[model samples]
Target: MIKLVIIGSGNVAQHLIQAFAKSKEIKVSQVFSRQKETIIPLLDSSKITTNFNDLIEADIYIIAVSDDAISKVSSQLPFENRLVVHTSGSVPIESLDNKNKRGIFYPLQTFTKGKDVDFSLIPICLESENDSDFDLLEKVAKTISNNVFKSNEKQRKALHISAVFVNNFVNEMYRIGNEICEENKVPFEILKPLILETVNKVMTLSPKEAQTGPAKRNDMQTIEAHLDFLSNKNHATIYKILTQSIQNNGKEL
Candidate 1:
């Protein structure tokens, strides 16, 4: 069995620890967190400590700390020969500053505490400096996910950007729709089916092909009416910008 230790006790750390615990080939030997309370629930009988020197011997140390604290925590760790990996997508693998075997085991999905993750559907992006280390990382990833990709630092950075655009920006659009519904006294829940359908359609059709709106159809009258209906200046600005962008794409609105 490959021994593993997880550092940090945030949402990402919690999700990873729970997932790794279920794998037969992987053994979670210890968990470390700066705060005693944060590590309480996850680290039952396992070796749990706040001090880095108390870390148990393991083949791999997974650091799931905040983006800024990765380097600092890594520098304090006592082990030198063991493989060290971080879970941040934006942070480069080199940030660990370890001369020993190092790599990134970034799970390309948003993690939330108390929420169960469908590990099989999540993409695991692996990167390493050496061939041996890459193989080791890939093996661990494949245990949980079928969708594994070898992405370099540059590629991972680009994917992170695209992720923010798709997930974050789409959520903002939902928020705008909710606000509109609230003002008009319409039930926001009524849009649930349509919202789900929109996502479902995009899976089978290109986003351009699935696009539907007055803007796509060049319905200038409807666009103008929608903009006029929106009392908020920010909403009006967003509508105008999106309308122009959709029109430029040449999708039959």
Candidate 2:
């Protein structure tokens, strides 16, 4: 079995601990959380540590900390020259201290606390300095996920930016829709099917091809109606900007 040590107790770390727990090929030999209580429910108390000095030997040390803390955490590792990887989508692998072999094991998905995710479907993006380290990282990734890609730093950054558009920005649109529904006393659930259809269409069709809306059709009448309906100035501004972008084929205004 491949021994692994996870550092951190955040959403990604907790989710990874759960995913790896179900994999027979990989063992979470240890987990480091400053407050041991945070990760106590995920693993045996014997396997949890509060100090970097208490970390046991493992084939790989996975740093699942915040992006800003990655460099600081890696620098504090008591050992040198072991495989160290972070679970950041945008942060480059070079952020890791040079004391150990550095790599990235970014899972390209949104993680939320108290939600269970199927790791098998989530895309795992791996990058490493050497071929051997990459092989090992790939092996561990495959145990939990079927979709794995070898991504370089530039490609990973681009993927992350695209993710922000698709996941983050798209969610913001959903929030705005929900707000509008609530203000008008409409059931937000009524739009769930339409939302599903929108997502499903994009699966098989290009986003441009799947586009269908007043904005896409250049229906200024409906567009103006929507703007006039939105009482929130911020919401109206956003609606106008997005409508113009769609009509202009996403040209910068």
Candidate 3:
């Protein structure tokens, strides 16, 4: 059985703790959190430690902390030469302390506290210093997820940037849309079906091929109407930039 010791009680760490709890082939030996109470509800109190020195030796020590705290936390570990990995998308493997073997176990998904995610569907991006450690990470990843990938630092960096555009930036656009709806006293639910349809289209069709709306059609009248309708300067600016990008991309076709 692959034994893991997860350190941190944040969103990613808590979700991992819950997922590993259900795994028959992998065991979470212990969890280290600054506040033991944060972990107690997720794990047995006996298995949660407030002190780093109390960390038990496990096959892998997963440091699921903030990007800035990774190096500091790894440096504080009482043991070395053991497999240590972090669950960060943008942070590189070298951000880890040299006291231990470094690797990355980034889960490419946005996590929120108290929200349940199907761990089996989340893609786990793995990278290690050597083949042996990578094999171990992959084994652990496959235990809870069917979508596992071996990603190098460069590829991982690019994937992370793409995720920000697709997930983060897209969400911001939704917020802007919601704001416009509210200003006009319209129910935001009115856009739900259109949103769902747009998402479904991208599954089988490329985003460029799936594109629609005034921007894609180059309808200057409709585009100008939208710009005039948007009273928020920031919103208008963003709309103009995105419209220009879509038109530019369409030209390439």
- CA lDDT scores, all candidates in order: 0.88, 0.95, 0.93
For residues 1-253, what per-residue lDDT tens digits would candidate 1 score against the true structure? 8888899899888888888877899888999977767767766845678888889888888999999999988888886867999999899888896755789999999888888998888999999888998898888888778899999999999999989988988899999999999999999999999999999998999998999989888999998898888899999999899889988895466
Candidate 3 per-residue C-alpha lDDT over 1-253 given as tens digits, one digit per residue, 9 for 90 to 100: 8899999999999999999999999999999999888888899999999999899989999999998999899889988899999999888888888889989999999999999999999999999999999999999999999999999988999999999999999999899899999999999999999989999999999998999999989999999998998899999999999999999993654
Give me the candidate number with maximum lDDT: 2
Task: For candidate 2, write residues 131-194 as lDDT tens digits.
Answer: 9999999999999999999999999999999999999999999999999999999999999999
RMSD of 2: 1.3
For model 1, what is the error of residue 210's alpha carbon versus the real structure, in angstroms, after optimal superposition? 1.2
**Residue 120, model 2: Cα distance from true site in angstroms:** 0.8
| Clash count (model 1, backbone only) | 2
Off by over 4 Å in 3: 250-253
TM-scores of the models, in the given order? 0.93, 0.97, 0.97
- Candidate 2, superposed: residue stretches over 4 Å from native: 250-253
